[model samples]
Each structure stands twice: as C-alpha cells, then as structure tokens.
Target: MDYVIEAPLVCVCDLDGTLLRSDATLSGFARDGLNRLINAGVHVTVASGRSLQAMRALLNGVELGLPVIGLNGALISELDTGRHLLIRALESTPARAAVAILAAHGASPLITSWDGTQDRVHHVKTMNAASDWWVAEKREYGDPRLRLSEDLEGVAGQEDVVLITGFVPDQAAERLLEQLRAELAGAAIIHAGQHIYCTGWTEFQIQHPQADKGHAVPHLLELTGLRGSTVLACGDHLNDLGMFAAADESIAPANAHASVLAAATATAASNDEDGVIHWLLRRARLIGAS
Candidate 1:
C-alpha cells in the first residue's frame, strides 16, 4: 500500500552492514519496503564502498531514483545509464608512492581506475591466499573491471587512480595502516580494517583525499536538484562518519560499529532485521501523520 508523502526529502543509505545483512544479501522485506518508499515519492539513493558495477549487481531489482555514491565517494554515477555524475582520482605522485609502499609489503594491491568509460581494476598475479581468493570471487562474478597488469605499479602511477586496495594478515594490516597513515599523511584517504568477506584478513583501501561519502553527498544533493530536501543519511561503519557530519540526520543499525552508533542521531534494528527499511517506513508514517 502506498500513501501520500508530500515532504521534499532524500535518503542516502549505505549498503554493506546497513542495507544488507551479514551475508551480503538484501532481504525480501527490505527490498519491498525500499520500493514502497520510492512509490511514496521519496528520493532514495545509496552510498557505498562498492564499485558502481558491484552495486548494480547487488541492487539488481531495486529502482534507484537518484545517482549512487560509489567507491566511497570517488564516484557518483547513474546506475541505470552508467553515466558518471562526479568522479575524483588521486594524484599520480602520491598514487605511485602508495603502490610502492604496499608492494614492499608483498601485497599485490589492485588499482581501480576509470578511463572516461568503464571502471578498470589493474593487478598482478596474486601473492597470497587472501588476494587469490579475492581474485577468484571477482572472477566468479565475471567482474569486467578486472585488468591483469604486467606492471601494477606502472598502472597505479597513471592518470585517474580511483582506488588502491589489498588484503593483508590481521596484525600486518594494523601495522601497515599506521605506516600508510604516517607516510601519506593528508595526501590520501586511507581505510583499513577487517575485510567484510574474507575471514582473518584485513582489507585496506586508498583513495583521493576529497573522495569520501561526506564530500560526495552534498554534490549528489545539488546534482539531483534536491539540495534543499531534508537529507537523512544512514550507515554502520567508520567510513560513514563524513556522511554523518554532512547530513541533517544520521541513522545507524543496532549492529553498527561503536563509533558509528555513537555518532548517529538515531538507532534502528540490526541489519539482519531489515533495520533500514523499517526505519524508513516508520519515518514516512510519522511524516504522513503530521
């Protein structure tokens, strides 16, 4: 059932650990509720660390009414049309430094970039079990972005460096995070923590300094012509902090990271319980009531 909701509003939701369950699947309840929101004239969109291609795959059946924030804000694109609304990349100098640093640790980091067209992920042969598994999974999806490179460093040093990512052993990931933070201080935005899918491994991602969800949300609002709309942002991770700061209201799932929960304006049920969709429905009800 659809009800009239006359408010000019927009909702920006994070994918992993918020909209999706622990197993990375969107529940039927959540999927239906999302469509209900769209039917009610709510401008709904997503902000995710996933690439545009991956996001499209994950949200295959959903109708996205606005451009999605992808690659942790390095990209904002229309999922249906595959049109880039905004794209940001790291400087070649710092990008090279990052590639060298990760390679020294024997991490064959995958460099993601765009050539004014489709996204490309460049990598050398896997150097470890974790990276090998990651590559295999990408292959399982038949991800078109995978670009095997003879010289990973050379690829990273080129123009349009969107993201540099790799997986390392748990303890080494922590150490490397600290080292990269210190060495590349302010030159890049570095995120390192437990890899969502790969057990016992830490995933690290390096992106341009300005490429973050917080910086991208405002641009999204303006581009969609919803700049004055009441914006509600939701997430369940540290990367969502910038987005939280930029939003009029912030929400988190019950299972969200401690930091994210503390920063949230409100809390909803765990992702497993379809927290995001529940929260959206409840909010719509309240708006309709008023």
Candidate 2:
C-alpha cells in the first residue's frame, strides 16, 4: 500500500477507541500506514482526552514530532520541548460549584489536574470496565493524587486544574446533563459518550460559550502552523464533533458514535480493522506498495 503523501500536511487523530483498539493497543497495519505518511513528511499529532502521561505510553514507539492536544483541548504540549502551547483551566469558582451540583445528584465526579505535565485525576471507589482505561494509565503513570470525597467543594479549588469528569449510569447520563445545564449556567458541559460526562470552563467567552471540539480545532491548527483546509482529523466520539467541524477534511471510524459518523466527511474501517492506517493509506496514496 503506497499511500505516501508529501510533507507539511497535518493529520490530527483522537486516541483511545479511535487510533487504538479497545484493548488500548495500536495495530501493526495502523502503525505502518502512519509511518508511511510520516516518512513522506506529513505531520501527525494525537488529539485525545487522556492525559499526557497516558498518551505518551500509547504513542511511545510512534515517531511524529508534533504537540498533542489533551483533555479535549484543555492542554496542548510540544512533544520535544515539553512546553505547553495552551492551558485552559476552568475557573475555580465555577468548577467548585459544578462539583457540588454533581455530588448532590449522586454522581461520582472525578477531578483532574495537570501536574505541570500529565494529568493527575481523582476518582471515587466504584469501578467499571471503562475504569480500566484510567486504572491502567494510572499504574503506568504512577498513582495519582487520589481523593475520595463525597463533596466536591474543595476539589475544585486545587490550583491548576484542567478537567473535571463524572460517571453517570447509562440510564441517567442524559437527564443529568440537562439538569447540569440549568445548574452550571456558564460552564462547559459535554457528553463524552460511554456514560461519561465532562464539565469544564469554556475556551472563549465571546462567540459560543460552549466548550467543544470545534473551538479546540482552530487553536490546534494555529499551533501546528497549518490552515484548517490542510488538516485531516480523525475521531470516534461526540467530543470529536467540534474537531470534525473544524477540519478541512475528517474521517470517523465505522464504529464511531452516530453523531460523529454523521459529522465526518469520510468513514474508515472500525478501529479493530485498523481504520487509521486504512484511511491514511487511501488519502496519501500508499495503498499496497512495499
């Protein structure tokens, strides 16, 4: 497969169930496809909700020199320099208030902070399969600053917090979001799918006060020194909608969320089918050469 393209084109990909299969591993086909693109000089960057520490492990062997967009755009860091290009922390007042509201609703809120580098997330005792994502990352990154509090009042005041997440049972997630909207009037709330709820501060106050992937994409383009038209973004969740909306062209894995699939310009194979590599090869014209 010789889908090799020239350098300077920017390709931003979402990690977790997008680039990596459900087992949290990248397929050989995806790796080779991405390598072909990089060898041809295209820039590839991972845009993910995972902290830098977790992302580093997943992207460990891949060699693409680009800053990653983490925490759904709350943090952007240069891979080589370790310098953060952007850090959008939710205002403490609103974060704290939002935490209180979730606690009252009996939601298990997790507070996350950037430890100058990488995220330090705190969660309660209950566990689920999705919890594997966080647990494995924590083991790899070392134990996080764990806090098991019923009240989130003090959790929000921590200095330099970037994201706050909570888990709602599949049945109640939607209703919780509606109630949250009414309670946290000015805050950013997003349905991250898989029964996960994300609440944070908005990136901008002037235009749309919502914190979305759309707002994050423009900032990423500027940081990568590419125009939106020159960028190709791939994602699989609703949180990826903004990024898809902002990309010059975008692809969603076949198993992607319905909304995300609808928003993307193209659909690749499922992640298990090595969709990242499949699409890259097709787009770059690297489909079947040595």
Candidate 3:
C-alpha cells in the first residue's frame, strides 16, 4: 500500500533485529528517517519486546513524542509522562501453574512483575549453569532491577505478573516450548532467538493472552485518537507476527526470520544497513510528508 493520501499514518516498529543494529543500537540513518516522519506529521512509535525501562534507555538520544509499546504489548508507556497507558498482567492461578510445569521440566523462569511504576523481576537463585548465563549476562549490564532469590516460588506467588521469561539450550527450548503451549491453558507461551544477542541460548516467554502486539496496535490507535489512520508495522521475528496482523501493511528486514519474512507486506534491507530507514523514507513521501 502506498499510503499516499493526505492523511496521517501510524507506524509501529519493532526494535531488536528490526530497527536496531545487531549490537542493539539505533543507527543515525534511522534517526534521520524518523525525524523526517515526525516533521511530516506522521505518528511513529516502537513496539518492542523490551521493557519500558529498557526502551527509554535504548532511546536515549531520540526525542520521540509518541508513546511506545513495551514488553511485547504488556505496556504502553509515555516517556514524557513516565506513565503507562495500558497494563496487562497475568492471572495468578495459571501463571503459578505454568511456572510449576516448566520448573518440573527443568526450566527456571525470570518472573516479571509490574508494580505499576516499575518492573520487579524475580528469578530463582539456585539454578543450573544454563539459566545462570542469562542472569549473569544481565548483571554484566549493571541493571539493578533483577531481584534474585533462593525462594523464588514465594516471591512469585502473586498473580499480577506481567510476564515470565527464561532461557535454555537450543535443543531443550523446543521441548519446553511444546510443553508450555499444551499445558499452560490460559497463557501465551512463546519461543524466540535460538541464540539471542549473539549468545548461544534460546529464549522462552509467557504472558497473558491479552498481552499481544496485535492488541497493542489498537490500544495505541485508540489512545492517540488516531482512528482510521493506516497502520504500518515492521518486525523481524515470530513474536512480531501479532503486530503484522494489526497492520494495514507490514515490512520485514532482509535478515528477519523466515516466518516473519513471509508475513510482511514487503522486505527491505537488513538491519545493519538501515532497512527501517529505507522503508520510512518511502512512507514519508507517499503521505506527502517528504
């Protein structure tokens, strides 16, 4: 779709392997392209798996006025206000059940709880070497938010958790993924990145069924009061499929996973070469914003 009419368009972008380079930094090419869109009056924001805190950290230099989607749709936070427009948390009963099942299968989850203003992540202190890698890697960033405990089952007893995520070996991730999907009746079980961020690990995440990127699209649209605007989405993984379903059009980077590539309306350059920038330049022009 050209989206060339005189009306504004809404562009929701995924961060990790879509807008950010492999090293997880937004490139100047994209920054300039986004600025052009802002000047042209398009509504642009990010929909990412990153938490709100992480998104703000990653978007340090960018002056984005629009509210960004975070935690894969678990939140819609406004940077200027330091407030959340939406909060979707998992129910206690099923979430605890999920943890028990995964734990039984030798998976230790990093439980994510949103205490309205911040994310309180709790993980079991006693764990195997595989789970330790994910924990240690985050610690290397000096992110003080993670709260580890030897008594994680007690720490995670509450039901208002936003998400629960974990990492495992590539071989083990497959079996856990299947088990989580079949057993966790009321939740969303997902797998991503066989080797996330260059690390040789596979990731697993669980959330409320309502906490989906596709749902975030409409929530953002409603909150912005930008009804009827064309939805332009871009992503690079299976997790982005929900975002694609909510779009009038979608783009996937050249390096995107095969499933994401198939779902996109078009394919652009790889992330390392400013693929999102290339797509946005065209979008800005089509809407007379260029």
Candidate 4:
C-alpha cells in the first residue's frame, strides 16, 4: 500500500474517553499506533481536565515526549522532564468569592495548589466525598496532599492557587454557574464532567479568566516552536472546546458529546475500537501496511 509519512505532526489529545477507551484502558492497537506516531516524530501531548499529578500516573507506562495541559489549561507540565511550562492561577480575591458562593449553595469545593516541587495541595470540606480522579490521586501519590477546611476562607488568599473545583448536582450546579457568571463576571466557569448527577450539579472547575485549555494550546505550541496550523487536537467535552476550536485540524471519537463532535473536522472510531490509532493510521496513510 502507498504510504504518506508526515513528520512532526503535533497531536494534542484528551484522556478519559478519547485516547483511553470508555473502560479507562488503552487498547493494544491504540498503544501501538501511539508508539508509531512517537517513533515518527509526532508530538503527542495529553490535554485534559485531569490534574498534572493524576495525568502523570495514567501515562506512566506510555513513552511520549510532550507536556501535559492539565486542569482545563490552568497548568502545563512537560511530560518527560516534569518541567512546568506555565501555570495560570486564580487570583485570591476571586477564588475566595467563588468558594463562598458554592458554600452558600450547600456544595463543597476542591481547592488545588502546587508546592515548589512535585507536590499538590488539595483542600476540601469535611462533607465532600472522593472522586474517581481524587481516588486515583491518592493511590498514586500515596497520601496525595490534602487539607480540611472548616471554611475555605483561610486558604482563599494563598498565592499560587490554580483551581477551585467542586462536585455539584446537575441542577444546582447549573444554577450556581448562572450565579457565578453574574457575580464572578471575569472568572471562567467550566463543567469538567459529571461523576454522577445530584440535583443537577456536576463536576466543575473554576479558573482564572485567562486559564483555559484552548488558550493554553497556542501558548504550548509557541513554546515548542510550532504553529496553530501544524496542530491537531482531539477531545470529548466542553472543556476540550477551546483547544478543539483553536487547532488546525480537530478530531473526535464517535462517542464524543454532541458539542464536541460538532467541532471536529472528522470523527474517528470509538475509543473501544482504538479510534486514535485508526485515525492516525489513516492520516499517516499507514493503514493496510504489510
């Protein structure tokens, strides 16, 4: 079969249900395809709502040389070197106000921060339960940095806070988001995803107005000496929208949310079918190779 080898195509991908199948595992075809892409000098980066620490654990066995866009673009870190490229954090004043609003609505927020080195600090109220991501964090980090807040007012003013997140039921989350948009006019409100639906709220992240994965993609490309037109991005959620819209070519798996699928230039096989590998093979013209 004829082949087309494109060198150094920059591919930014999402986790969860994109690269990793819905079962939270990487299929062999996907694994081999990713390895092939890396061997061909493609720059593959993980861009997701996951924290840097969590992403590191999930990608531990994969050998990809690229930085990660984490926390919906609030944090960026080099995958191989563990170097922090940039971190856009919420300013204390707005962060505190956000927390107060959530608290009043009977929801608890998860506050995230980074120490000077490899540690992450997460503060949550006593009543809050663990999230799948949070559980993964604890298992990997061995006592992932955590603190209890009688009230988040104490840590609200701390410097270097990157994100303030909370689990809300769908309806309440929707209502709180409406209020937040009005009250915290300059802040960015994102619904990362839902673990379960409670009263209509879902998992959400509150970030600095400027912190968004979409905004981070261009910045990361600049750092890597690449251009927007040279990049291809794949994602499955609203948080992925920013980068999705900004990429030269955008792709989504068949199972992607309607909004996400609508933004992509093409749709690939579902993650269960090793969609990433399937798409990459076609893009590189490697399919049907003997």
Candidate 5:
C-alpha cells in the first residue's frame, strides 16, 4: 500500500528489538530522528510490552504525539498527562487460573495491575535465575511499581490485573505455551516465544482477550480522530504480529525474528543500526544522515 504524505498519518512502533538496541538502550541518533518525525507532523507513538514508566525512561527526551500502547497493548495511556485512555484488564477468575497454570508448569509470574492512579506490580522472591535477572534489571531501571509478593495467586485476583509475564527455558516455554492455550482457551490472550534480547530464554505474557497491538491500534485511531489516516507499524518479534496485521504497512528490522521478517511488508536495518527512525525519516521524506 502507498502512504500519502499529505494525508493524516500514524506511526506505531515497537521498542525492544525494533527500536532499542540489544542492550535495551535507545541511541542518540534514533532519539533525534524520532523527535524530527514528531516535529514534522507525523503522529508517532509506541506499542511496547514495557510498562508506561519503563517506556518513558527509555524515551526520556523524545516526544510522543499520541497515547502509547503499553503492557503489550493491555494498557493505553496519554503521553503528557499520564491519563489512561483505555485498559483491557484481565478478570480475576481467568487471572487466577493463569497464575495457577504457570506455577504448575514451574514458572512464577510477575503480575501487573492498574489501581486507577498508578501501576502495582507483584513479584515473588525468585523462582529461577532468569526471574532473578528480570527483577534485578527492573530495579536497575528504577521501576517504582515493584512489590514483593508472597502470594502471587492472591495478587492475580485483583480487579484490574493487566499483565502476567515470566521467563523460562525455550523447551519449558513450548510446553507451557501449549498448556496455557489448551487450558485457558478463550479466557486470556497469550503471547509466548523466544525473548528478543535475552537469548535461550522464552518470555510468556498473558492478558485480557482483547489485549494485543492489533486491537489497540484501531482504538487509538478512533481516539485520535485518525481512523481515516494511513497507519504504519514497526515491530520485531512474535508478539508484534498482531500490530503488523493491523497496520496498512508494516516494517520489520533486519535482525527481527524470521517469522517477523516474513510477515513485514518491508525491512529496515537492524536495531543496532538505528533502523526504525531511519526508515520513518525516509518514508516521511525528511532529510537527515542515517
């Protein structure tokens, strides 16, 4: 599909393997280039598995012209005011069932929920090395929502449970994914596969049935009065497939997973090469060194 520059346009981007480098950091070149796109009247926003606060930390200096899709599209929050535009929270029954299934399969989840005003993340002490590393990384990032929980199952019964995520070995992940699908059925939305940054480890995320980038994109278009706009999306993992399907055009980084590359309408340089912003700049017809 051809994108007309003159028409209203929206660019929804993924963070991990699509925008941020392997070290989970954003480069100056990307930051500047993204700001330029926003300045030049391209409606830019992010769709990420990261929480809103974490996303903000990574995008500290950049301006997002629209609400961001967070928690793998379970949450959508306004950029400047921090207001929630939409939240597809998982119900308590399904949440508890999912937690129990994960535990039975030898995985403990980091549970995330919204309490109207802010996020509350409940985590067990540690189930494995990967879980320990995940907690440490969040601490290093200054994640304020981290709450030590002795009863993760109880936390899952909360009213607004948004995300249940964890990491496991690739082999275990496959089994766990199969079980969750067979058991949970239509109760939750599940995304599981190899981690984009942490090799040998697979990440599993469970959320509300309507929660995924594809569903969030249409809501965002309506909220921003851009439903008629040409929508372009960028992503780099299995979780990104939903957004890719929803977008008019989808761009995947060269380093993206094989499935992601195959699904994309076009490809760009790898994340280390600052691909996303470069692609946007060229598509927007903006002049800048890539």
Candidate 6:
C-alpha cells in the first residue's frame, strides 16, 4: 500500500554561504527565483544567524514579507515588525555569567536579545581593536541594536539576553570553547565559523538550549499549517543543523562545511554559482509549480 501526504510544502533557506553569495549579497537570479517560488504557492523565507534588523538590511529590495528566523533561532519573527512568533531567551544569571567568562579572558563578546517587541545587542568591557572594527562595520549597515558599554554592568538590567557571540584566534577559540563547556554546562556552545573577525580565526556563539534552528523551523511549519509536510531546508554551516534536522529534505552548497556536506540529503552548486536558485527552480518544477 502507498501513502499520500496532504500537507503543503514549504522551503526554508539559510542566508550566509547558502542563499547569499560570498560577498553577503543576494544575486538577481536568487531574488527572481524566490519571488517566483512565492508566487507559485510555495512558502519562501529566511532562517539566518543574522539579527532581524540585519536580515532586512542585507535583503533589501527583495520584496519579501514572510517571517524570518533570527539570531541562530533565538528569534522567529515578522521581518517587518520584528514581532516574535516564538522566542527563547537566556536568563540574566547565565547572560551575566557568559559575559563574565568572556570578559575575564580579555574577550569582549557581543550580546543579543529579543524582548518580544524589539531586538537589542549589547557589547561591553572595553573592546579590542578587532572588536572595534566589527562594530564600525555593522554601523555602516545601520544596525540600530548595537549598544556599547564600558562593562556588562547595568545593561538590559533584569532583561533576558538571547545570544552571546565572541571572536578569538583559532587556538584561543578552542580553549574558550572548552572553558565555556565546563563553566556554562547545559548552555549551547557553538563554534560558529572561522576567519570571521579581523583579529580572529574563529567565531563562537552561545545561546539558550532551545534556541536552535531545528526547533524554530518546526515551529514555523506548525504555524503555517504545514505540519508533517515535506520541508526543504538549505544551508552551508553548523548553525544550520537544527533546520536540517527538522527537514525532510536538506540541501547544502558544494562549498559547505564538512559536517554540513555530510548531513545534507543532496548538494547544490556553490553559493557563488547560484546553486540555491537552481535547486529551488528544479524543486518547483518537480512539484508542478506553474
């Protein structure tokens, strides 16, 4: 006997190194392809490590109104309003502890929070030169949530922080990861990527245990009334694993990280080659999107 599935299909995509090219911009082919997908009754949206504001900034002119997953799944919200569909925040105690650990080791971590209505980011304790460069870069993009402080003291008092990120030399990042694992047991410690900051070879992000793309994507599917339907998720990094885990079909660019490539159901072209667009068009055709 054969089974027939009735739920609608939804396509969830990652931003960096997946949909967006190496320069952090979307290609014309991708934009047109996604717009066409949306027009064909296929739900299209972004699930990114970027904050809500950053997402809008980077995706400018794309003409999309769907919800987005932000801050590595700490936030799921409307792209325009930043209203949270589902949120998981790091408690004040842990947020402070995370800050303390990074500060003690001369690492100035960037703190992010989603308090339902808006997204806020806090940076504390005398930033290093590289940290300053990162701040300047984001400022050029009109990042409004970036709050600078002399120290972590009295920032967002009593309010929960959702994500904490830091950058350090590859070796130091490794050590920090070990230290964080031991100090912040049960906390999500992720070595996000490498060569991200001007002075560092690795970037690490810490978040609430439930702040994961896997959980967030499923929640979105449920909200869209597509529960149990075939979900096509795409990405090129470890942060994308959560979404991959929740997807029935997962796609990774040819240049994806080793781990991601291994887990992907199939490989698409490299982002520079517009592999995501190719996959989407092919998928839409297969599903008879006309």
> Each candidate's TM vs. the true structure?
0.95, 0.83, 0.89, 0.88, 0.94, 0.90
TM-score of 4: 0.88
Quick one: how many clashes does candidate 5 have? Answer: 0
Q: Write the per-residue lDDT of candidate 6 for residues 210-229, one digit (tens) a residue.
A: 88898898888777677777
Best by TM-score: 1
lDDT of 2: 0.68
Q: What is the C-alpha lDDT profile of model 2 across 155-190, one tens digit per residue?
A: 567655677765555566667777767766666554
TM-score of 6: 0.90
Model 6, poorest ten-residue lDDT window? Answer: 1-10
RMSD to the true structure for each prediction, in A, is 2.1, 5.0, 3.4, 2.9, 2.7, 4.1
Q: 92, model 5: CA deviation in Å?
A: 1.3
Model 4 per-residue lDDT tens digits across residues 104-223: 776676677765565455555354443335544455565555655555756767546777777766656668778878888866555545653233347767888768878999888888
The number of clashing residue pairs in each candidate reads 0, 16, 0, 11, 0, 1
User: What lDDT is reached at residue 214 by model 4?
Assistant: 88
Query: Could you tell which candidate, 1 or 2, scores higher by TM-score?
Result: 1
The 10 consecutive residues of candidate 5 with the worst lDDT sum are 1-10
Residue 174 displacement in candidate 5 (angstroms): 2.0
**Model 6 pairs in collision:** 214-242
In model 3, how large is the Cα lDDT of residue 226?
A: 86
